[model samples]
Target: MPIFLEAKLLVWLSPLHRESWLWACPELEEKPYAIVPSPIDPSQFYDMKLPREGVICVTSLFEFKGRKNVLQWARDHPGQEITCAGGNPLPNEPLPPNCRDVGQISPWQVNETYNKHKAFLHLPATPQPFDRTVSEAYLAGCDIIGNKLIGALSYDWFKSREEVAEHCGNSSKLFWEKIEEVLND
Candidate 1:
């Protein structure tokens, strides 16, 4: 906190984080700060026009990431295809029969995964500072189903996962407009 105060500038990746930081230290209100989200190369992630089938959850296989919730959801929806990407499942944490665990996918592969999957789930136990996966999924045209704390400015407040998924899909122009707005600010 002391070092932060001494710093000339603070670059926040998302407004949610910026707001949390300001709330934590009201004294920092006068400090210089900017919310610039991590960049995503459009060339690397294009709409492949692939069939958006099945559900996918991308995140480290940690308990707090709501891996258990994903597993339970998979169990409840046996007919739906579910894929879990990121690190391997924890010891003794066997995945359900309906779920396929693709541990630790590369960024390029993640783009492809997002393109292929129709829905993306991110049910983290705690609030995320910023979930880049959500943006990636949205960019790739996947339906987003996650908690409100995802920190992506594009998503509207949604109650149910289905409600969120219904609003999936993104416009590159809109995304670029947001980037320009933040950068120009």
Candidate 2:
């Protein structure tokens, strides 16, 4: 049996995933499906008084998450500090001097890290379903930079990492609106 037939509603984190599903099972197009990006509750994040600084990357220390790319980016930008918050470094993989590994952090801690960082970096080896961290970082007012395969949303179309901060202010509200549209449908 097709899984779509068994579900009341199908929610996809990205349009790419939804399109792929419909392409694979064209019959499922009749089913109710929504392309809703991941959500982040603003209340969970702290608003910082100090100016944000440095570049921050949050992902598991796995190779697929593009840890090497982030390390390389850190090395390339010698003057800027880069902080990584996620699972510990892989065995025998030492972080670059410009990059500081914070290991794994709680959601709240991630919010704080976003509050402090000037930019967020993510370079996945494969396309991401929907990176919740992108939304969280936007809500925390950090500039976004990295893989174009992050999601189906407009943020993925951001012109540049440096310009991403300008779009951050309204993302949280838009995120909720999309969720409401999905739920109401």
Q: What is candidate 2's lDDT per residue for 1-185, written digit by digit as tens?
A: 45678765777767666765676788888877655555445555445755789988888356777767777777788898988888755846777788788777875577777888998888766566677777667666777787665762344544443333334434556657656776687
Provide the lDDT at 76 for model 2. 87
Residue 47, model 2, lDDT: 51
The residue-by-residue lDDT of candidate 1 on 1-185, one tens digit each, is: 89889866676766677777788888888877655555555455556898888988887357777776677778888998888888765846787888788877876587788888988888777556667677667766778777656666433433343333333233334446655665687
Per lDDT, the best of the predicted structures is 1
RMSD for all candidates, in order, please.
6.0, 5.0
By summed lDDT, the worst window of 10 consecutive residues in model 2 runs over 161-170
Q: What is the lDDT of candidate 2?
A: 0.68
